[model samples]
Target: MPETTYSSDASGQGTNGSRFNRIAMALFGRQRDKLQDPFYLLLLLGFISQGFFWENTVVPIMLAALWFLLIHLSSRKYAINETTEILFLLLALLISIHFGRTAFMRSLSFGNGLLVLQAMRMLRPLTPREKCLSAGIAIVNIAVGSQMMLEYGFILVLAAALVLILQTFHKLEAESCGFHESKFSPRAKWKEFSFVVLAMIIFFLVFPRYRALSSVTTNLSIGRNAPIAPTLDPASGGMEGTGRLIFQISGDDIGYLKTFTLDTFDGTRWAAGKHASAFKRNLRVEPKPELKYRKAIVKEIALLGGSLPADGYPVALKGNFFQDDYVSWQGSIRVSRYWPADNNIYEYWTDLNKHLDADSRETASCLKHPELSDRAKKMIADTTAAAAGEYNKARALEKHLRDTFTYELGTYDLNRLNPLDDFLFNEKRGHCERFASALVLLFRQMGIPSRIAIGFVPVEKNEIGGFFNIRDTHAHAWVEAYLPDRGWLVFDATPVSDRVLQRPASGFALTMRDWVEFIWYQKIVGFTSNDQVMLYKFTAEGIDVAAEKVSRNSGIMILLTILLLALTGGIVIFRRYSAGKAGRSSSITYSEIFAEHFYRDLLRELASAGIRRVPSETPGEILRRASIKIPSAASEITFITDEFCKIRYGGRKPEEDLHDKVKSSLHAVKSAIKSRKTFATDLH
Candidate 1:
């Protein structure tokens, strides 16, 4: 039986016999001592997650991580001499070059090229510089991802990568200066980390954001779903679809673009009724839909404020024209002044739910109206009598109207005194307005409070825009009946035209993917100088008011604090520099640099003992192989390798005496090798 002795490599791999074990160890690693293997794992995880989150394919990152892991953990397993080693290096170089070419082309927008560079740099036998380079690559990768990532999950990924990357940089910092530690304490590392993070935040916040780069990159129409925000209330049916593109609305929650509501119908026309509350300018809608709301960035050509077209209930409004905008009690957004007719851009947030649901319905009995003709009254009576519930009555009325009347866009006989009566009995045809108006009247006759809502039914979806496209012709009218506890419930009595197409609401999967997507893009990358100015103005008002109240001495205190911080930072740097001065005698030897020297000497000494070391075998593996011939030196070899690896790769500096201790152990191994050869000669 061959007695085998094992040792650890600085890169965290151990010796294993046979080709399979060698490959396995190299690929997975046996590193329980250092963070290199774990950091690589975390780095690979970031790559995989980002690849999946971004449009980049995960398979390439997967393969790259596998290759890097194999090389990283096994670099010490093979020396520069072997043919296998040569082939591995050659193949790695070719793949890296290929990645460099492809990743550079794709990385600026949304590619995993920097990750490949990071993996390449992390492969074993790393200098402090290479590790720092890899860490920098990680930071760059995160910054790039933030620009394109829409999902909220990216925050978690960023948090993890930030932690791992900081640790990696911290390890490198320790390796660089651990020879004589003056003050690289935990507090100092945290301060450095805080400064790095603070600097990034300052750069992001202080810089005037221009759309030059993001405008081109952000509008990337590649493999993207409808990003903006998720809808809270979605319906199965809407008005007949049309595609003239009156408004290009970007948001997760958009269905019907309601312009205004009409509570008064005079048979001649439906008009907006007076309310107890007048229109008022406000910052945000109180009692907003929990967290579910749409931040719609609307780009409307030839649209302005008599009644601003808002999708759902307007929660908040922001734009040049919207500063003086007033929202009516009936959910009408209107600006007191004229807005630009062309290329008008504005942003607003609206409630996600189209209808407020508190649950439980209340029914109203049919009421007699003297103004309505007998024929009109008869139809309303029949609709109320046949229907059971409030919703069923509405549904029955809808079905009756849809079945009886043909949807015609052309004008009907409106010269008559009672146009509602004429449309129901004689003409039996009109557009959405006529149908909706009659339905509202009929519902009112049934003692149900109802109103006419004017808006464009978003049946026309633009796939290119990933949002509903609203045109002038897509303007629709629908009736909303009041239900107790459950607020206004929408009921469309207009017949569905074949021209009407249904736009599917975003699925749960897509909803999750675009959860915070539009908000993030708009608030971050899509934020313009105008937005910055608005933010600054809003912030400065409070700051200026506070400054007025602040004592003059308080300002001086703040200045002094800044100066004090700078002085402390300077002192820390000076102490760090002074630690390496000539007058000071350090206790640490930095023996890691001499690890290869001792390793090479061991290989030479073993070769002289009639056991030639192979390039394919690492120092640990060579010692194990030689221990079979000279088993007496097995413990001494393991001890020496342990000390060497801990100092070289583990970022643990060696004490002054530790170098002498390793040399003494190496001498014992040489003596054992000499005795083994002598015993072999005596046996011969």
Candidate 2:
């Protein structure tokens, strides 16, 4: 092999090539095997953050810790074989099955199963493609968490997780390109991240949101479960307190939030009857003359099995977003297809006084009770026998039940043949369902049309925000009896004293927490098409107000002018301060001024000469390509291209004398092209 010596220019070119290669490697290098551990750790943190919204606590934490330890140990040169992978998969499957059964039973939920699979995936060694897929899985976990709970804390956690994931991927890219380990400046990373956050906020505000209906239909089941609808099945277990917050309402008074009404009693279960037709007919009907109507806003804080809650006899319901929501045949207002995930606000015009429609056709189904014992029928007859008017009889029956029966929680047994019989005669102690059911049966026995209204009673009033905080524990069932001439009136047979005593005292802390939750749902999660419209309306209103003030009040106008001037001065000072802190000048420099003029001249000359630059073509590339079309101006064009490249990329300072030279070159190029065109025209 012969040793070859290169000239100075060749040596300089080689140095520049090596430097470019080094920079490229720094940006796109492959990460070391050891770096995988840290990447996995970041992913583990993101996965565990999602668990904060899950129902199960211990399992998610344990799985995350196990996965983290496994990754750490594996990084120390421990080989994971096929047997270990199989065992891990089996363990994940078993855990998912167990958690799914414990949480939702035969219908598996994505909550536990998602976490289990993510952990299992992390357990195995990952390829570059697998790592990207893992990042995607982590994002899905975050998305699920967001769907589960739309809170400020959840948003914060999601943003943090996203930043961590992005940094991890950035590191992976750097490592893959063979770059040595280096620490990225937090300030610079945050500066870049700020733009991403701004873009997301803009998209959230401006993007047109189409309604997405839920695919999963909520199963209405029985037994000590959260109230999802107005219909109650006595065969289901007693209503137990889950202590989960369901929804919040803002109204003048704390009232019952009715979701459904059960009209037919067929021994074991109360269901919707022919009254559904009457209810549906009256869905668009106006309230009775005697009923007082009030406006109420219901904001769903959490998913209560996808059920929409509203006050009794809702005349009108408006969703936060533009979507079709209809009233169920049973008088419950339901979302068209699926239940909304979170932040679904409904504006309802509710009849404050619970009055049933007077025009509704009375059916035998409301009075039919196939399983009612003869003794129970006689007891109901005795209770309302002395009452002359239907109202008096209803009041007497309500008083009798409230005075005699004791109110207690967790008293109903699903196994009993007739739980109502046990509640009325044997046990004599039951929750609102028993009281309501007993009252309804008594009314039916007296030949009065009656039904059970199953829904939430807003008991806790958030004094701070003037909103009612309704929880699952507030679920109650009551009776509604149809009265002649007076329409249907609410008759509560349940003792109120026990429930009042059981109510927790609302403190300042609790009030503030409720206020925060209300704000979170209304301002952030609940923002919709209506909000965007309202925003524009508000801005327009503000402008009109400002104009009016300017026209009417000279003193106020002067103050406004002063304030505007002050604001402008403040902005100027702040920008100057920022530029100084960043070690940059706020004013344009000589090079920038020269570059701007040169660029504009080149564009104007090219446009006049019938030469246009494509969007994708650079200035230097355009100049060289256009030189062939205008040969007479080739030298001027080349000179401009070289000068522009020097000023733009060679870090050379612009000289005052070079500015005139550039202008002369541009003028010469333009004149030469014109002359060539005229000569060609004459020849033709």
Candidate 3:
């Protein structure tokens, strides 16, 4: 029924600005000086401005800051206040410019800019408008930087920037009416801090992420010129291995990296090798089990972010890599196009079956040759015929080569005429490339469609993500001889030398980096609609129908989701109702309730009467003082105040009559203030 009249004594506009200057200087770890508060506030404002808005206006603001710094520097010599602000602003501008354009350099620049801006504000603070500008720019930097290169490292920089922003601008009001201590009061400080943290968390969790970066981005051709004619050597870019180590594949068995399949073999080499036109064409291969202990190590290959091997080929064997409409086998998994650089991880599987197959034996012997001498050729023919029907002739050849030749790497210059001849006749030793090639030719001479395959065997494995690290040094050549029923049987002719598969010390770090790179590529850069579907499927776990429905874009799933949400809501509502019914009612009397109303009215009356109570003041004291000022309402006000105190302190019952009386008393107090014209005159 009554509006409370409020008043407060005109409190002196405290020199809060000076106190802020001292506190800000203390926080920035700078020596106390006249300019410190201004500088610190500038830095704080810069951060706020950057985080909230990133417009060209920031440039002018920065320029103004610079001009101020310059003036301060000219006037004050060697003072921390002046020098630091200049340095911070200059550094921030430099970092912003540096990372503003280039992709690789952007993260560093953006992070530095935040630090510089914050430091600058700390050194020479700005208006609230400027603080907002800085905070806006910070948001732009953080949002863009995360999309470009989101790493845990960037997270750390963001946290630091947030802290700097708080220290610089938290106490400075938008009005810039020389800082106020109440603004930094512990309660307010904590409240602001909590709000900032909550905002950052929401930004982090809900912000939509960009496509995953390419795993192959790590192997980006950073401005390197293409070679005129690359050689087949690992050192050359042609048949050369990727200098960047692809993640390793390892288990109990080693696996080979599949390059493009050469179906068309020329007399001297396996050439263009056209794809077997018909999908049903099966080239038979088989290896006897009795000769060797068996274990098929199937490698699950995820093509990370790099161009598919130079030749576009689907990368995995049928029944092993994937079963999908798009996949087709050409002797090997091959794609007609290179994998895109938008880092994608394509899953492929390969069976690593251990076997000393017939083809393997023949490969060892032939690889030991230049172009099999007449004697060597005859030996191969005889071995092939002796074990013709069902026995193993390849094994015999393998035994002979093992007994005679030694394993060696890098004996002959590749440019030399008939390099294989040099290895076979003069050197009598060579690495897998020379050996595998020779063996393949020898096997072909004996009527086997054996050919040389080049790629690295995975050597070391990363523990964190189980990635195989296939290095340039791991580049190897092996043989694949066609068998009758099983298709092409794989065989390695390289002698198992301890040094051959040396795991470099840097391999572990490189592997870990590759795994991270892989994540970036598949999740960000190479994320296709297909990948999204797969991710949804995987998240759905192994429910095939669910996966199929998801892949097919079945809207039935949406209905299911809605049903699930409704059921969950119904359950929650039921639980709340059931809990409420279990004797959970709450009740309070009228006098007890009136105490709250009386307290608020008393505060307003005192404020109008030119003696506003501080936020922390108690009710009894205000009532006692109000009674002294206006004796006419003293008894009534004291009765209300005493009852309010009793209800609050002693949990006394609040009555309806008491509540009505308190209301009447509050109206009378307001009328008294107005009659004396206390509400109208003091504020003026």
Q: For residues 271-323, could you state the per-residue lDDT of candidate 3 as single tens digits?
A: 32323212422212232222221111221123221112211122232121122
TM-score for each model: 0.40, 0.52, 0.48
lDDT for each residue of candidate 1 in 1-684, tens digit (9 for 90 to 100): 133555746653456445554555555555323324434545555455535423456653665456455554554543333354445545644554555433432345333555544544444455455555655655665555544453465667666765676666555544453221222456765787788778766776778442221211111111112111011101111233333445545557566677666665444544455530146446465434353333344444223225566766566765533335667666667655433311234667666564653212111211222376778788877866867877777788888998888776545345346667677777777677777777877877766767677766766544434555556566677776776656767787777742643444556665544434434545664565545766787799989877775655687768878999999999998988787662235423435457767766766777888778665544455655776877899888776765565555554566667668778888998999889878889999
Query: Of models 2 and 3, which has the larger TM-score?
Result: 2
For model 1, the stretches where C-alpha displacement exceeds 4 angstroms are 1-46, 49-124, 177-184, 207-435, 439-453, 456-528, 550-684
Model 1 clashes, total count: 3
Clashes of 3: 94
> On residues 215-316, what C-alpha lDDT tens digit does candidate 2 reach at each position?
344333222344554356664546566677766777565456666677877677776665542325323454443433332334333344333667666776
lDDT score of residue 323 within candidate 1: 36
Backbone N/Cα/C clashes per model: 3, 13, 94
- Give model 3 RMSD, 1 decimal: 14.0
Alpha-carbon lDDT of model 3: 0.48
Q: lDDT of all the models against the reference?
A: 0.57, 0.63, 0.48
Mark the regions of model 2 whose C-alpha exceeds 4 Å error after superposition.
Answer: 1-207, 213-239, 245-254, 266-279, 282-307, 316-330, 334-355, 368-389, 396-405, 412-428, 445-447, 460-470, 497-526, 534-684
